[model samples]
Target: MAHASGMHSLEFKLPDLGEGLTEAEIVRWLVEVGDLVTIDQPVVEVETAKAMVEVPCPYGGVVTARFGEEGTELPVGAPLITVAVGEKQPTAGTGDTGTEGSGNVLVGYGTSEAPARRRRVRRERPVSGASATAGQTGAAGAANGRADAAAAPVDARAAGAAAAVDGQAGGPATEDGPVPVISPLVRRLARQNGLDLRELTGSGPDGLILRADVEDALRTAGRGATAAPAAEAHPRVPQTPGPALAAPGSTTAAPAEVRTPLKGIRGAVADKLARSRREIPDATCWVDADATELMRARTAMNAAGGPKISLLALLARICTAALARFPELNSTVDAEAREVVRFGQVHLGFAAQTDRGLVVPVVRDAHARDAESLTAEFARLTEAGRTGTLTPGDLTGGTFTLNNYGVFGVDGSTPIINHPEAAMLGVGRIVPKPWVHEGELAVRKVVQLSLTFDHRVCDGGVAGGFLRYVADCVEQPAVLLRTL
Candidate 1:
């Protein structure tokens, strides 16, 4: 629904979805052209690497145009929808930059809730064809019940291509023309990283820019910078194009094999783990715990007529308590600043495997939640993970992680640490094992516990102490009662 000529509308681009999520696939659209919508109304559903989220429109007016189609993967800051805000509210101040809002921050960019940002002047630009079309058809269609709008849908990509040719992406770098990027996220990325977009080429349709292009340039520059000192210390050499693709007619003997692209959530997880392995010097320590009393304690509590406590929630409670005494394990190493940043609040992340991939959903301030509340939140987040409705915020902000791989029926594993986080506690299966109980050979419920910690954050003594405390709590449920 491109706006018609003489219509004043504001175009909304996709917002940043957090946790380094730069792009998402549009799963579904909640609104259609000619629809009158209010601010903060969810207009689209998008799926990112970690979860599915509904993106809301920031403007209130008639929806004149929508960009992209279902399943289209759009970078942060791509055009999402255009709204006839100025036309809908004639009595409001018409200052050129006055793009008033409800002050709710979306993923891509945030708006100030203060009066100054609320009353600022809007930038004046030539009307896009979509806007012009929206203006003409909107007035006519609104009177006739939107029949024309329903009959003919606007193609957002085609209009963008047209805009590119007409120089609507922006005129010259400054005066009339602007950079082809419409996303503030991309601009902010470049600005914060000190990247110059003018030196790079866009990989999007019709020379349109994208976030990936900027990121690639940044990486290249970083490599060059590191090589600069080496080059100065050594000798300079002329660069040459590497071996040509063995001529088009060339053939080589290679075995047939299946290949899969590492992408989306799986790719993201791979990159993080690889970097963790490369950068963090980690060590793992394990201990076998007798959990006969812990199981009895849970059973007695359940039989006493209270909310049923989940095993994971109980383990999480133990973790939060353990972190309190061993705060050194609940911190990250800041390589840039060479500082150890410790957090007071326990943002506990738990590993849950989903159809898409493995995701860690965080429970913010886990130290404050009781067993009942923890159980409820764990259930909610696990369900959200399985259903693909978890948001980016739900997957980040963790000071530590609890990996219960026992659900898969494993005894023990030296798991890779989730990067930036200093430690991960792994729990194995609880099964009956012969033990010396009460000075006699007897069968008792036992479990294996392992702690993987960054050596930079803590020594083996502290890590051993944390693991021993957790194991003690498992063997004697009364040990945790002391903390309460």
Candidate 2:
């Protein structure tokens, strides 16, 4: 029996939700503890450093306990929602799940789930001038009220009928309470009949006025008193001729233009970057260093039959080593909790220039990979990124970032901090310049290295020291050998 009761535990950790965000706030939960959940089912909505992202369960089973609650702030790698392993049919509204939390990162896009609740339809009665006139007078008021009740929850229809009856009695109907919010369709219908929007109450969600509500209002208004029929349609209509109808046998040319709305990654990227700039406190620092040794190392490594790695790759290795010493540089700002998360792994993001602006494809487990492996992986990722072949996994889990501007002939640039991660290192092109070598002036391969980090995480001293460490490694690749 014990053997038959075997169970598998799946811990769904939070992943990079994009815009380089490192953490998120739990916005809402779809399921509670002890409830059954299917694999790929949506579990919760988390507002990341950039946007609200819905994370789905990867495995099906009972949801024993959710790790956090609504409003709880969670970090990447933190257990989000857990599921038990079982064979359950794939269901609609099921989210994408794979390999525990090691699923593809989707480059920079996050997922969305269907809204938690379904909408309910509302019903209301209709009113017209002809009905109002016949039902008005003392008898008409009663008739309209009966009609409104028969129509369902619309008080407006009843009220309108009462008014028509009163009008027939040579007096206006007693004014009712404030107008109800009616649905858009109802409002449009009433407008077609020249109906006032203020006369109806809404029966939709949160008492929102629905089209039916307006119809009910109109219906009541027409119950007892004689009145003209409401307008057949909205009063407003464009006078200009629409596209001419094509001749039966004539070929029609399509419109000479097209429009497509931005979505998915592009949409997600825009929202995230906007949010990052709005929420995070940013600071940038710049410095020029002699990179003679960095160039030598790259050439030697390439000649050694290793994959050709860019200066950005070398910078990644140096930044990873430096972050090891100053882990604080690898931390994230938790504005909601007023805290910071110092990460244990170095997932570096390389700002690869693509046809569609700049995209930062992340290198996961950077701190653990050796230089040669790092070179190959960087090559693979950049090539994939540039060629638009990056799987979701190739673009996420970044703990830090690097942007190289030297390739474009720029001497130096202060790059934006790739958010959540405390800092980003920028490497510039190698230019020959006079330098002091062995206490003498000589030409050396000098490249500018600018470090932009979140000042909230590091002070000038800490940031400066980190940059100096990178400069040292670039000046002498042998130094990276020791640091590694």
- Which is the leading candidate under TM-score? 1
Candidate 2 minimal-lDDT segment of 10 residues:
225-234
All candidates: TM-score: 0.64, 0.47
Per-residue lDDT tens digits for candidate 1, residues 1-484, read 4434434567788886777778877655666664445566667777677676777677765565667666467899777877655433321233233347555546533233212111111123435666656655654554344222322343232233233222243332222234665333355456545677777789987776776787787676752211111101122343443356555544332323323334556667888899999989999999999989989988988888878998888899899889999999999999999999999899999999975579999999999999999999999999888766777788888999999999999989999999989999999999999999999999999899999999999999999999999998898878898778
Q: What is the alpha-carbon lDDT for the whole of candidate 1?
A: 0.70
- Per-residue lDDT of 1-484 in model 2, one digit per residue for the tens? 0001223345567776554666665655656543445445566755433333456665554443356545456677777654443322223354432334324332233335432221111212444565534433332243333211222222232232222212211233232232343222233355446777665555776677765565566556652211222222212332334378766654434334333223334445676577778766777777778888778878887888845676666777888888887888888988889998888888888877753235678888889887767878888877765544465456666788888887899988867677667788888888999999889999998888888888888789998898888888888788877775
Error of 1 at 221 (Å): 53
- In model 1, how large is the Cα lDDT of residue 240? 40
Error of 2 at 457 (Å): 1.1
Model 2 stretches with alpha carbons more than 4 Å out: 1-264
Off by over 4 Å in 1: 1-9, 18-20, 32-38, 60-64, 83-86, 89-105, 108-261
Please report, as a residue range, the 10-residue window in candidate 1 with the lowest summed lDDT: 224-233
21 Cα displacement, candidate 2 (Å): 14
